[model samples]
Structures are given as structure tokens and as C-alpha cells.
Target: MSSSGLVQIDGLSPIRKEDRKTSKVMLLFPPEWVPTAPYLALPALTSVLREAGHTVVQRDINIEMYDHFFTMEFLIWVKGRLGMQLKPLQDKEKAGRLTEQEAAQKAVLEEAYAVDVFDLAQRSEDAKLIVRGERFYDAEKLERALNTFREAMQYISAAYYPASLVFYPMESNLGYRPGVSKEVFACLDDEQVNVYRDICNQLVLPSVSKEKPTVIGISIGTQMQLMAGLTFCKMIKESFPDIHVVVGGNVVTRLQEEWAKHERFFTEVFDAAILYEGEHALLWYIEAVNGQRPMESVPNLMYHASGAVQQSKEVYTEKTAALPLPDFEGLPLDHYFVPERIIPYLATRGCYWGRCTFCDHGQGYFDQYRGMTAQHVVEQVTALRDKYQCRHFLFSDESYPPALFKKVSQLLVDRNVGIKWTTLIRFEETLQDQAVWDLAAKAGCCTLYYGMESANERVLNLMDKHAKKSVIQNNLHQAAKAGIWNHVMAFYGFPGETRDEALETRQFVIENQPVIHSVELFYFVAYRHTPMVRNPDKFGITIHKQEEYDLPLDYYYTLNEPVGISCLDAMQLCEEFYKNDFSPWAVRVNSREHVFLYISKFGTNKLPQIYAATKDGATTAEGVSGLVTWPMAIGEGDEGKEGMSRVVSHGVG
Candidate 1:
């Protein structure tokens, strides 16, 4: 791939869409999408696909689509359409049930699921609402809405199309962090949008060539994953109609229920939708499309054919070791902005403490705490480093328990590969062990992102996130001493968060400033599949829903006592972020598991001197807010000539 993301060599199109019997797949990520990551169906899906002896392509579109002119205008428009509140599918006993919670969830489902008939009419003029998102959705209408969005974006600004990868030019300049986040796409100007649109459109239609493989596979890791998939499917359908397009990842499963309803979209854009982990599923799709295997037994597959949608048998429980280590070689290894791969490795899936009431990951015993052989992990690392010469890695594992850390501590030391890495580790003194610390530092573990959920005891219990504040603090101090960058994820605005407790969070940050490198604050949004969403009524929490999309603030909780701030105070919270150059991070601890000694700060611009100033100290919060405008929005102009001096850039990469 050229540094410009344009193939300087002639006719480097991907594998053709024919010869479906061969094991080839194209994974796609969507453009200008939201969500840090999506439909994380990859780890499992990739394994499923690979298990079937098929080639899989991982498309990192979450970062890719942002390369386009993803204007704040689009975001604001989406916000206006979806509203600021979330519809967590709560208050119902089941996901689709219509009990009180279900009723509320249903109300939202009705709205979001349905195409804005008026908008559709406005866009298409004569096109009828083929699939209504009403109680009885016509599959035809669903297709129309999707086609409409696609057509609109394609036509309005498809000319400038050169920036398919937003960071393509500035990639090497980035530090060890991941690609510019979705948030970075905000405040896009007309010039940036036109350039980005042109670049993206250019990549959309790959010129066919002999080098084009028979089939291509793309992986959707974030919302952009979906967007990328959307474009790839369309492009392939238009350019290489014979190629079978297959799609799968985590997000697909969550919305499978809705997606399953929209058959026309799949029939037109893709051949199959693999909702389950596809390590083996890709093979199934290949075999099925290529006449290699039967679909009856292909677990977790959604296919559209003969004007009907066919879903394969569902399979959940699978052995971790049985899965492949993930094929990272095919990716542009050197293209990784991080010096090292920032390799998102995981020791295992599933949290041992999978009792978080609000986490979708806790459902169906999906993420049961399971450990991989430390050797197996090291072996993968060895392979990546030897092949890609990666010097740093970032473990994307949601949790790395003490035992797993202890078990690998020595192996990493002895293996002597001398790589640096970071993982999401629980707050435990075990990390303080000299051997562990020494090995980690030597192994390239420079930072640890710890999740100290909250300072509110009641909220912790409610969320089932057990961590004592005292222990968390101690862990941070020890981690700081251990020479690790301690970025703590402190959450506020959960149930039972009193103003006093909220203030306590601030106090903790101020007091532990030296120990903690950075802090992050978050308002709780009940995950789609978590117990909080499953049984919201039992806890007296109500969630409002919106159609089309959701955001962080859209989710809110009601407690016996209103703690911290309600959703209504979301602005006040903004007031805090905008007024202070403090870079808007949070910190927390509770009675359950502690997650101190680490934190991940979102990289923003450097605010004015927050250390010496206050909202009113020789300035108003408005004056200090890096975002000069309303609601702390860091406008595009804020990012000045070389790199804005205002947006705080300090963060854990």
C-alpha cells in the first residue's frame, strides 16, 4: 500500500468476488462512525473464520472512515434525530419483551427501527416506504432507508475523495496511540471534508486487476467497521457483482435482531452476515458460497438468499485455546502509528467478575474469565515481533487478573524479548512485586490503564464493581513508584452518586495528583446486553430510548437518592470540563475489586494552565473551556497551525 493509501503500482485490486468455494473473505469498517469499538465480533469471529481455513481481512475502519470529512454537522444532525438520551432496552425482562421496560425499549425500537418515512420520501421523492420501522416493519422499507443513507452520503460530497484513511499522511507522526478517535472528527471544515471525501471515494472503487484475489476479507472493529463494510459491499456489488460478500463482528450480533429484519439490505449489499465469531464461519460461508460445506451446521450465520433470510444454528461456549492467535501479519504492520503494534492483545476473554449490572459483556456468561497459556500469548507476541518488529503492545483485554499476571511475569522476564507493553490490569499489589514490575518494564509495559469505577460505595454495589477506595489509592501509589504510567478511569454519575461523593472524586484526584498520571470521567450507559438492561425495573431505573443512534449522555440512572448529577446536569458536567484545562478525566474506588494503578486519558489539546486557574479564578469556566463555544465543544479552529496548543494531548497511548 502506498503511503498515500493509493496504489502507485497499477491494477492492485483485491481478489475477485468469484470462486466462492475458495476460503476468502472481505471484512469492512464503516466511515465517520461512532463508538470506540463495535461488534467486537472479531476475536471470536476471526477465529471461527480462520478455523475454517479461510483468509480473513481485518478492516480497521473505525479509524479509517474518520479520514473523511466527518463534520460535527453530521453529528449534530444525528443528535437532533436521536436525541441526547439513550434507550438502554431496560425495564423489560427480555430484550424484545414489551413489559414496562420492554415497553419503553419498544417505544424506542419503534422509532429507531423505522425509517423516517418523511425523510425517505424527501430524499427519494418517488420511492415508496418499502420497509416501515413500525410495529410491523416491511423489509422493503428497511432496504429503502439504508439505500437512502448510502445514496445521500455518496452524492452530496463524493467528489473530493482522496482521504480514505484520515491519518494516511500524518500516520508516522502519531505517537504510540491508536488512530485519531471518532471524537477527533468533530468540527470538520468544508475544506477538510472535501479532501477527505475525495480520498475516501477513490478507495471505494478499487480498479480491477489480475492481482485482485478471488475474495477479500475485512474486519469491522468499530462503528467505522460497519460503515466500511457498507461501502465495501456496495463497491464490490457494483464493481465485482459475482464476489460473495460476507459480514460479521460483535456489533452485528447486538443489532442482529434488527438486521435480521432487514433482508433487502443484505441481499443487495452482501451475500452473508456472520453474526457469530467467524474463525470458522468464514470457511462455512466460503464453502457454502463456493459449494464446499453445508450451512445447516455453520454456527452464528445470517444469510440472505432466494428472497429469504436464513440464520444458522447458534453456538456460544467455545474453548479459548481452540481459537487462533489472530492473523496480524496481513495488516500493514509498519502502518501502525504506534512504534510497537500497540498490539491489542488479550490474555483471555470474559471477566471473572462478570456481575456488572450494566455491562453487556456480562450476559449469557459470554465473557467468562478464562486464561490462555502464558506461553501461547508469548508465542503470539514472539511471532508478531519477529515478523513485524513490534517494540510496543497494548493488551485490549478488558481484564487481566492477578493469577494470569503472576503466571506470565517470569516467563516474560526469561524469554528476554525486551518488548514494552500495557494491559488492562486489576488493582492488585501483586503488580508491585519487583519481579513483575521488572519484567513488565523490560517487556515494554510502559503504562497500565486501571478502572477505578467510582468513589460512591452504593453505586459500586449497584454496578457490582467491587473495589475499595483505600486499596485503589494504595495500588496507584505503588504503581507510580513502580515506574508505570498510572492512568485511572474514574466514573461518576452512576446510581447512588451523591454530590458529596462526586466532590470526593475531585478531592481524590487533587490529593493523588502525583500518583495518578491522568483521570477519566464517564456517565453510565446501560450496555445493550447487560443485566441492568435485562432487569432495569427491579432497580427502579428507567431508560429512555431513541431511534437511529445512541450516545454516552443518552443513558441515565435514577437512584433512591440523586447522586453526583442527573442527566439534566450533563451541561453542568460540561461546565466543569470546558472551564478547566484539567483535561476532563475521572477517578474512583469502591468496596469490590479495585482498579487503581492505571488509567487511560483521552488525548485532547493542552488547555490553558488549569493548575493555577479556576472557572472563576481570573477567568470564568467559559474562558478556560478549550472549546470557545457552547457545551465545551473543541471546535476545528481549536486545532491550530502545527497542533493546537489548547487541546490536551497528554494521554496513555
Candidate 2:
């Protein structure tokens, strides 16, 4: 290995011409992620491989699956699958051996069978068109289209009964706990509830067969993608034993240690895994497979060899400036559920403010922070704009640094990039100036997502966020004043946060509704690698580990002392806040892309049509309360149009 852990076998003699030849590679992004845009990982890796003279075909299976789900042909096929499922259950019921669960599955299939598949499929197709056309701007029509999608998802769920699959939020449960290795393995082969198996058969395998790529790389970025990504790996390995299967992404990086212990994952599911930054590592691995380099020299790689799993000794980090712009060429951009293409661009690799005790996002990167210059950012933004004709961008940074934020905003304006954008940012004292916000808005900043974990200063300090209440308020006010939509995300509990402190956060958001256009409140999760979980006593919490959860990424925890809100209490508090105070944030359109597009369309933060209609037929404005929202609850005696209008809306923050 070289000093930097890059493969150093160029001087070595090649074994054979076939072994030394360049290989065709296929990169697959698995499902259960938001299908609004192409994830940056595939394109980022694809650019490197293609630049290296290898033929690369990148597939966004997540968006492809969603696109296929609402089609007439796919829905008709789902109807047949549902009938097949019903037959087995009906046979069991007739034999008087059906269990309660089986009977419930039978009922689901029966109800699904009763629906007119042809009519449902037509509506489903129309739903797809509405989201991808001018009708998306009509909130009412878009809402109905979204409802049709949910109905189609419900119909498909019957085929894979007990597996809850959703569209917008990209949540899917395959009736198996993903954290446990045994269950995860069992889920891969399960013909009943593992919906991904059918998805692989219909979508992934045929593509693999046609492309016949020598190597396949699957990116599993989130926990939700784990089951689906792994299923794709296993199925592809089974069908094409000669093809090399590799997995990588944020989730893989976080669980690298645990994955080392699971020998079957390397031997059966995937041939190798990449950790941390994957660009250089993957290129090195491909060279190794072609016999031009030794496998051990590939940095950030782990593979099964000689009856054991081994990780490369030295880890390599990417030079942010050296990497090429993400290649979005092969992805089906128009298939995404947006009227216009919205590209996701990353200028920074890791969090600059990396001290938050609750965050494990930093663990995904070997280096905590590396960012490109403001001029470089604007240059690439313009390049992407010209190449893809996409004017909306999602700056998928961990947190936009205040200095870089100001510089980039000014550069965008100076260069006249003319692209609408949104990104997550921290509330910085340096960003108190109104000119910064105005410049950002003028540079086409449509929205900003703030990780304002708590409004209480003491709670913020406990989390090591150190953001002042004054700064938070000032940031929101200025951003709003500049016509930018501010979406604030805060959690209910930290280890030592009291009930009153949690209430303080709730009250702060309620009082600042005019400035905070949207809100998301979550209960704290003790990720296994978070600073708080690592030093439990220091954070006044005791981490709980379950033996069966061998592949665990997070853990349950308890307060070390009886002085703060317990985990259960945090959950209850979040529920209470959603029930009582979520009215103002419950929007007709919940997807971030949709909201960003709306803000860009209206050219203002105040969108009355986007809000839920009040019981008195008024739009629920900021500071409004007790109004029925999109996901309104149904009362015992309520029915018909009035009841439907009273339902509250639920969506991502």
C-alpha cells in the first residue's frame, strides 16, 4: 500500500490481459429514500469511474420503483400478486388452520381484490402526471393526487401484507427488525412480506441482466434503505455469481465495526464494502479486481479473504476540491415527482459545527469538515444549471458555515447564477446582520432548515450546540424578513433537559410562528456512536443494549437520574405538541421539494394557499391555531366532506 493507502501495484506485472482489462460497472441506489431527486452518492462515484475510462451505468432504483408503482402495468401486476396471496390465505382459512395474523392478511387481500384495478391504475397514472406537471402548483389537485398515491400504496401493501410501505417520507417496514442480523437475513429470502424481493425481480434484476456489468455497487445511505439494499445485493449475487457486489454509504460507514463481525454479510450478501468517502476507495477496488493492484491496498475497503474479514490498514479521505461535479446524466431526472428538475448539490463534506452531543452524522466522515470555495460553488452551480437546465438546487450540506454561507450567497448574486436553493444551517451570532439574509434571499435562497434543537439556552448548552436564544430569534426574524421560509427542527428531550425546558421550546416556536414558517419536533434517539452514548454518565443517561440487535446503529436509553424527561416522556411530549400545536406547520403540500417549489413560485414566504383550510373556510395562517389540517383526525360521529376537511396534515420537516 502507498502512504495514503491508495493501491500501488502499477509497477507490478499483470497476471493476464483479461484480468488487467477495464471492467464495466453498474451502480445501484436502492429504495426507501425520498424519490424527489437523485441522491448525490451514485453520481459522485459515477463521475470518478467514468473519468477513469470505465463504462458506468448508474441507476436510481428508488425513484424508478416509485415511478413504476403508480403505472397501469405495475398496478395490474400487483393485482395478480394480491390474488395469489389471497388464494393461499383462503385455502388456509377453508382448512380452518388460519392464525389471527393470517386471517388479517386474508382480509387485506380480499379488500384489495374488491377494488377495480383498472380504475385505480388510471387514477394512479394521473397522480403521477399531476405531480410532474403544472397541476402540482394547485395545492388542492396535488393533495388529491397524493391521496391517490397513498391509495395505490395501500393496494400494493396488501400483496406484501404486514409490510407498511409509504411514498413521501420513504418509510417501509418488511415485518422484520432491521437492527438484528438474524431477522435481516431472514427477511431477504422471505417471499411473503419482503416487498423488496418483488421490487428486485421486477426492476433491478432485468437491468442487471441486460447491462451485464462486471461489478455492482449499491449505496445504502439510511437505515430505511438497509433491508432493501441488502436484499438487492443478495438477489443479485444469487442470480449473477460472477458479478462483484459491494455496499457503501453513511449507514455502512457507521456500522463498519459491526459489519466486520458478520461474516455472512461479506460471504453471502456482498463481496466487499466501502466505508467513509467512497470515490477513491471504489476506484482502487475496481483496479484490484482487474488484477492491476492488490486488494489490501484499497483504502476504506473491507472484504472476506482467507476465512476472515479484513479492513484496509490506512483510511483515505477525499480532497473536496479535487472531486468532479456530480454526474446526473444516466438518472431518470424527469421521472422524479417534481414538475421541474431539482438537483442536489453538496459543497461541504462534514459538519463544521461538529460538537452536538446528539449527532452521529459526523461519524460517516473520516474528516469532520472540508468545503469548496464560494467561487467554485457558484461555478459548479452554473455549470449544472446550463448542463441540466435545472434552476432549483438543494444544498445537501450538514450545516452551511456562516462565513461560507455569506460568501456563497454574495457570489451567487454577483455571478447571477439565478438558481433557487435551500440548505440546512446553524444559527450563528455572526449571521445577525440583516444584509446577509437579504443577500441570501436576493441570491435565490427560497428556504432554510435550522437544527434549532432547543430554544432554551441551557438545553442548547447541554447539547453542546451553544446557540443563544437571541441569535436563534434574530436568525429566524431576519430570514423571514428577507422572504425566505424558515423551517425549524427541534427535539423534545436531551439527557438533562427538564419538562419546563421542553415546554419552553414549544412556547418559543408558538410565539415565533410569523418567522418560523414550518416546524418539526422529534424525540431524542441515542445513536450508538453519538457523543452522549459514548459517555453515558457524563450525559446522565444509561445506554441499553439488546444482545439480538447485533447490527444496531442506535440504542434505547434511560436517564441516570430522576431529574429530567424520560424517553417515554419525550415521546409523549412530541405527540402532545403535534396534536395541539402542529396546525400552523401542517401544510397542504408536505414534501420539502414541493414547499421549496411553492416558495420559489410565489416569490415570498407567505403562501396562504399552501396552508390547510380552517373549519370556517379560512386559510390557516401563521399564528393560527385549532384549525383542521391535511391529516385531520376523524371524530366518532364525523363523516363526509366536513370530516375530511377536519383531518390534520402530517409531513416531514
Candidate 3:
């Protein structure tokens, strides 16, 4: 074994021509651009490999693809395309084929013409510089730049392809929405919608080739990334036929049975699939791949054997305290879309509650909740802060373990890590304590995203969320009292939920608007592996059509019979309710990027004040207490349209 404890082996005396020999390996995060903030999976795996004394290279191709696509040169190309493809608003006959979204892009194109192309280009450049921290943050300038960036993406998608690439997440038509094998393969085979293939080929493949790794590991964390992950696997197998390919992530962990039954998928795309947490799995698998042992010995692995699929004993569970600080060896931290870099760390894995019926977050091997010691957490942060010269951080745990977080919060003060962070947590009774909230705030807790799924007690019970509506209200009150921004994630349309219950959720948001700074409302999605899906009858839901399109495995169900409201009805209800005021909508929080700018100018406690001044133009020191303004989206009709505004119920100082 090597000094770092990684197993090492010698090649055969003469190394057979067929036995490709190299210890180098590359870990990849495939694209489907979401937040430019680093995802935690690759870094976690990288830490494992490096601690085991292996040569590992990690890359975030998702952010890289965005950086490559959003360039001045590409903007020039988009400008030229817009000149030809966009029709005047008066050309009704020619514009008839345009969808609502496309027509909106046409309006953006027309607006672009009002300003000189060169001037628009200058603004675009300034936005890039501002995003990269080259210019000062002006609220108006930031708003204008974001609008210009959005329009640029809209123009490209509308004129050239069928995709949505914007400031937030990137969406493409080739998503693995149809979880079945056939639909996924069809989308992968279609080059028109699969623009990521070209992106991988032009930008990623060259870099991978240069690394010359013997094995390629791809993380497929969400259904959105399935196609891109498979595309990379297919490309690598075709180009470097001798290279070994491995796939794993949250999505892979859930679809083990689906992959096993459809063995041909793995045969054609990857060599093996890591079942659960990958730290130990990758370490053992790499040793086996190095010819030190046989593949059958690797735990929690699914691979092909003699024309049939085979699985190894499932026995790898990571001890969080044992994990080394993640090594971001080859990742381009500076290239992420934001000016200030935010490092992602998972302080724990699996949900502590582990029983939300609408969630599959704790199914199968993921049910066991675990967390690192508070000391370890602080040490990891300090090391990362020193190494990256970045003090911004985010905990990517399923739900940041509350008890662990409280301990770490105290440690942060003693150690003085000097970092600002955000994390997701449940609205449990433990956090209602002001002492806990104060510890978090003193440690620089900027935001806490609570799973305030619903305000209706019945809906909460049906979903097995186990959180009482009143308790949630108190938790938000305490969090806000600590001066931390409280963001609530809500959802309606759970099985058997009535319209009255849905309305109650909205009313709850309005009543607690003082405590809750932002709200993200989503309709319920019945995941296939959830307890509710397993016993749909209990929830009075019937699975009518499991497969909606040729997409990855997403659920489609209807209440067995209407219980006061249907899914469609619930959706419309929420939409109409929030139509006039969007402040409660999470869209206004701006935490993804602008929140950092806000804090830099105004102290953490004064975020609401800056928000009021910028968003509402309030003259008083207290700022506006009722309505907030949003820059009108292109083609949104009028300047002060109700649909284009967000309203905050309380003033912040």
C-alpha cells in the first residue's frame, strides 16, 4: 500500500498489450447548468481518492459550459442571428408560429434594437465584469445587466434551438424526463436537442484526453443530468475504448433496479454503477481496476458478468468524521459564474426525520442519518477558506442536521472561521429556541431554507412531514429574530388536500410575512420510491399514467376522486394568488448571487433595508412596508403591470 493507505499493485512482468495501464482517474460533474456554486459530490469523492493516495482530477463541466457559451463572441453570433430570425411585432402573419415564450424573445429582440447593438454589447460586457467582480455593484446596473443576459439566452434558444439558458438553471428539451430506457436512448441519440453532446465534444473531451485517465467517474445527481451523464459515458467509451467508466449519484442510487433490469443500458454506456455513497466504493473500485483484485470484491457495485448483470455485497457506509477535507485539485473555482466563490460542503447525509411521504430522499441505502463532529466541520471550513481564499459556503446536506449544526455554530465562533454560509433545515421544534438561532447568527448564518411544505395540518400529515404548522410559524419567528433571512419552501396539491387547505397555506405566508423574508411555492410531486407512491391508496391517489413522455422516471398521478381540488385546480389557485405579489415568492430573495452583493454593501442585518431601497424606492429610513418593484420583463405589456411586481408585507431595517 502507498503511504496514504491506497492499495498499489505492480503490472505483469511485460504488461500485456490488452492490459491498459495507468493510475490516473478523472471525476466529472456533467452539465445541466444550475447554480454556478460548486456542487458537493465531486469534491467529496475527490477527497476520498486523494486521501487514499490516488491520482484524481475533478472538473465542473456544468459551469464551464455556461462560461464557454456566454461570451462576447457568442453574443455577436446571437446578435447576427436575431437580425435575421426575429420578426417585427406588426408581422402577425409571420409571427403566428411563435409560442408565448418565443414571442417574448421577439419582444426582447425589438427592445435590443432600440439601444444600439454596440451599447447593448457594452452592457453585456459590464455584466460579465460585474459578475466577475471587475465593477462596482449598482442596483440599477445589476438589474439591467441581468435582463440583458436573460434576453441574450432567450434569443439564442428561440432563434437557434429549443432550450432555456438563463441566469439561474439551464433547461433543455432533451432532459431524461421519461425514465424508461427507450425514451432516454432516443433523446441521447437526437443531436438537435442534445446540444450538450457538442459541448462535451468541443470543450470537455479535449481536457479529458489530456488528463489520459484510465477511469472516468461521472456524477448523475438529478434526473436533469441523466442524459448529459450518459452522453459523456457514451462519448468516452467510443473514443477511449480501453478506459473504464463508472457512474453514481443520488439519481443512480434510486434507479438501481431500473438499471439492473435494463442491463443493456449499462453495457452500452458505462461499465459499472456505484450504488450509494461513493467515497469507499470509488476507493475499492479503483484498486480493483488497478488489477490488485477482482471487480466482484468491490462493495455496493453493479456490473455485468458473463452476459448477465451482477451485484456485489452492499456494505459501504461512510463515517462522516473520517472523511478528509475535499481536494478541489483541478476544479476552476474562479470560473464559476459568480464574483464571490461559494464552496459546497455536506455536513451530513440523509434526512434526520426520514419520513416525508412525498420525499424519496431517505429510501433504500440512504435512510441512515449521520453527521461529522463539530470540530471536524470547523477544521474543514478553515482549511477550505485558507486554500480557496473564499469565505462563502453552503451546506448541501439533505437537511443540515440540526443538532450537528447547532454544535458547529458554536465551534465557528470559538474557531473564528470567518465564513458566511447558508443551509436547508426542517422546521423542527429544536430550532425554535432563540439560543440556537443566536448561535447560528453569531457564526454568520446568512440564510436558512426551511421545508415549510404546507400550512395545512392535514396536508402535512398526509405527506408525513411531521411538522406542525404552528411550530413552523414559531421557528420562522425565532430565525428572523436572530436577524437571519428566513426562506420558506412551500408546496400545495398533496393528495386529498382541499382548495381551502391550499388557500390556508397562502394566507399563512401573508400573515407571517414579517418572519418570512422569502417564499418558494411548488406543487407536490409524488416521487416513485416514496411511501405515498408505494401505498397510493392510503393517500387516495391513483396512478393513471406512470410515463408522461419519453423522459426519466417522474411520477404522474391523480387523486382517486376529487377531494375538494384537483392538481390542475391547485396549481391555478397558487398562481392566481401569487400573481400580484411575488415577494413571498423565492424569486425575489436573490440569494443565488445578488444577496452577497447586498451583504457586502449593507451588513447582514440590513439586507432587508437595502432590498427595500432598491426594490421599492422607499424614501423613508424604514423603506416600504407593502409593495416591491421588479424590472418589467420584455413583452410583459406595461411598466407597472401587477404580474411584473412583487410585494413585501413588512419593512426591514
Candidate 3 lDDT score at position 471: 88
lDDT of 2 at 571: 82
**Model 1 poorest ten-residue lDDT run:** 636-645
lDDT of 2 by residue, 521-567 (tens): 77787877777888999998888999999988778889978998988
Question: Which stretches in model 2 have alpha-carbon errors above 4 Å?
Answer: 1-20, 618-653
What stretches of model 1 exceed 4 Å from their correct place?
1-21, 29-200, 207-216, 316-318, 339-341, 362-367, 429-439, 546-564, 581-653
Per-residue lDDT over 1-653 for candidate 1, one digit per residue giving the tens place of the 0 to 100 score: 32312211111112334633445554544443321122233434555565555666655444344322233334234333333222443333355554564455345434543434345336433221221113112223433443443443433222222122221111111111112223222312223223332333445445223224445544433232343455456556666777766665444555556566666557666667665344555655566566555665565567775678877544434456766655554444433212123344655665555555655532222224676888888887777667656555555565567776766656777888666666666665445555565555555556666656666556667667776677677777766666666665554555446666766766777677677655555445544555665576766567655442422212334554443466445445635743463433221110000111111111211222222233554433222211212232111110110011011111000
Q: What's the lDDT for residue 580 in model 1?
A: 66
Quality of model 1 by C-alpha lDDT: 0.45
333-411: candidate 3 lDDT, tens digit per residue = 8876566877777666666777777666553243377777888888888989999898888666666777888999999
Clash pairs (backbone) in predicted model 2: 630-648, 630-649, 631-647, 631-648, 631-649, 632-647, 632-648
| Candidate order, lDDT descending | 2, 3, 1
Best by TM-score: 2
State candidate 2's TM-score: 0.92
